[model samples]
Target: MLSTNPFALSDTRAPLYFSDKVALVTGGASGIGMATAELLAREGARVVIADRCRDDGEELAARLRHEYGQALFVETDVGCASSVQALVGRTLLEYGRIDCAINNAGLSETPVDLIDASGEQWERLMAVNLRGVWLSMQHQIRAMLDAGRGAIVNVSSRTGLVGKPRLAIYTASKHGVLGLTRSAAIDYAPHGIRINAVCPGLIHTPFVEQKFGDGLPELARTMNPLGRIGRPEEVAECIAWLCSDAASFVVGVSLPVDGGAVA
Candidate 1:
């Protein structure tokens, strides 16, 4: 059973303003994706949790079923065009329409020197972190177009907006994400779909811990001006709001959920 009290309720079921909407969160198995899925479910949206990790994705979906009874797990490799198309197809088949999508599935810092980075690494990162978003948006927007309304939040990194040393491929992929977000936002707003990107700073998630080290959370926390790394729930809150009607006017925005990291 999903705990009723998660220490971050935010005023009782988050106003239930999202009732009846369908949401698909890529990378919905762990970290920021998991957090966003839980929040969306709590807000009364039927959620499709898609990820490459079937074990974790199925487990999370089952838990959500036990809690909210409106979650589905779809095994997806966003890097593959066919897989992304199938994901959207399944979502529409199950839910009738998609109201929102969070393209949160991404890769960690493959910290390689720019000059030393091979074409293979570059292509690999682009396939998932960049091309994945493109393919997802392609299929997702097609469905939303038929419905005539939807929203999209692509999970970008602070590095996407700026640059981070030693992770050339990752950085380039993020930059591509922002470009995609902006272009799609402009092209889709006419169809009643809004496209935006969320740029998150260092957050306390399993990915971060594994990438940096067990003690990396402490390091990330202190590196920020706020003296603490961000939490998954914090990023989730931003996504939930962006996916909600409350942000209807928001489009083509690259909102940074960083703690003064850009400053």
Candidate 2:
């Protein structure tokens, strides 16, 4: 049974670990991003949701506000520098500081052989999956630097660490994300900013469903050693922990939330 009181389950270590903080979540209208934003709000963070999907983003912000006090939505295109800068600007303007940030906006495609992949495909994937994370991080780090302390969790993927059969472009993009995360972590850790990446396995999100379709069940059973699809909330839990003070000493690590598949 779930607790009726939202604060009751925020965390045992700190019932309100994020109380009086500001969190920015890109791609926050759905899936793992949505879960992270809601979790942050439950823990008392003033949440700012950024996504190109204006309707869903605004709806989520409204719901969070009704339940948790402060939440706002900003439509953003992570691939665009100006858009990301505006997102960070809006966050700071509305909430004063960014104590935590999650770069979750991403794009993937139907798997295609490396030999047949087109330059256009590569560009699209790089724009959202790689460049997007970089751009979001660039602006986010600036805000965190001014605030003097913060945590950032970039949503990498299982493809980040290993090659997928026909997902060459996506794999490459995710790998780039991990690279950005590590180097940035090193650059900013001394300044009290912790940067890390989460590599999620076959999570049962709308994306996974759309990609797998009728084969999802069988794919879930074989994709990971756990023989099941992971939940967005599972990844959200890991992300939340990384953003919290409990992970204070942690930095520059790529934690796999892959149901032992990577092992």
lDDT of 2 by residue, 1-263 (tens): 65764435733435467899899999999999999999999888999999999999999999999988899999999999999999999888888889999999999777788999999999999999999999999999998888798999999998899988999899999999999999999999999999999999988888788877999988888977889989999899899999988899999999999989999
lDDT of 1 by residue, 72-161 (tens): 999999999899999999999999999999999998756778889888888888999999999999999999999999999999999998
Candidate 2 achieves a global lDDT of 0.91
What's the distance in Å from true for residue 152, model 2? 0.5
The candidate scoring highest on TM-score is: 2
lDDT (CA) per prediction: 0.90, 0.91
- Relative to the true structure, candidate 1 reaches a TM of 0.93
Best by lDDT: 2
Error of 2 at 33 (Å): 0.2
